[model samples]
Target: MAIELETETADGDDFVVYNHVAPPLSELDMQVIKSVPPGGNWADIPLSIAQKSKRIMQIRKSGGRTTYYGRLRNDLPSYTVSTYFYRPGNGSFVHPEQDRMISVREAARLQSFFDEHRFLGPASSQYKQVGNAVPPLLGRAVGVTIPSGFAVDLFCGAGGLSHGLR
Candidate 1:
């Protein structure tokens, strides 16, 4: 069977989509996904114990911040950032690893957002947007099933699946 799908980009660009059938995730991928916490990154764990870590360089110093280079909300300084241990239940303001919450860019990368994707607004706003976005990789996995039959996306937000479908 074949199916046609429509996707729209954040900028409102439209495209048609199709896909081929593929097997479900293997045991290893499932295990990895299961092991990883939601919105968590390697930095969530202690540096001495973490398997991976990422550093985010801010565009401007926090004291004299410019809109173009500050952290997503301009409230925090640029420094080492990771989502290795972030969890919604742990509270909104606590850092998943260090004493500060993860930055917007850090959250975005964990959610599979490409570095090239420019986010709009302040640091906190960006973090909220990135945190709320669906992981693009997961959306791509779902898109792989489009060619086999009709696909429905429940709780679609910002159309990540639609982007993947294309």
Candidate 2:
């Protein structure tokens, strides 16, 4: 989705704004976006052209493979866009296409984490961190209920809730 900025002539006022309606995704992209499996890969598509076409092999080798789980940002155009995917397992060295899991960066993006957010540790650790994160958007929405005087996070994961509250 795209957003536009508008200004008023009478007051010479500047304010950020948005359209009341959003453009729709292309039908094919919508189909692909809808078909994503929970904890599974696009390869799980039974009749997908990606699965049936011989090009699957080429894409596996060249384009490589990644999962495209939906992101919370789908609901908020002003937020950074992101999505997530899970890998098959913890094994370190699997074929690019057969890796069975999505990368940490991919998972972070799925959670609307910005490209500049630095994740710590190796790939496996990064994936673990991403998997454990709470969507900051959700946290912010929830933070509104906290009392103004003092707030406490209970069983918060990775301080995502705290970060949002602050």
TM-score of each: 0.34, 0.35
lDDT of each: 0.40, 0.42
Off by over 4 Å in 2: 1-86, 89-101, 150-166
Cα lDDT of model 1 by residue, 55-144, tens digit: 212111122222111112234443323332233212332332332334444555556776557677654455556656677887998789
Error of 2 at 134 (Å): 1.2
lDDT tens per residue, model 2, 1-166: 3222233545896543221122233454344434544434445434554544454445445644443222222233322222222322111111132212334444455566654577776545555665667866677877887778775676488757567665
Per-prediction CA RMSD (Å): 20.2, 13.6
Question: What's the lDDT for candidate 2?
Answer: 0.42
**TM-score: which candidate is best?**
2
Candidate 1: deviation at residue 109, Å?
1.5
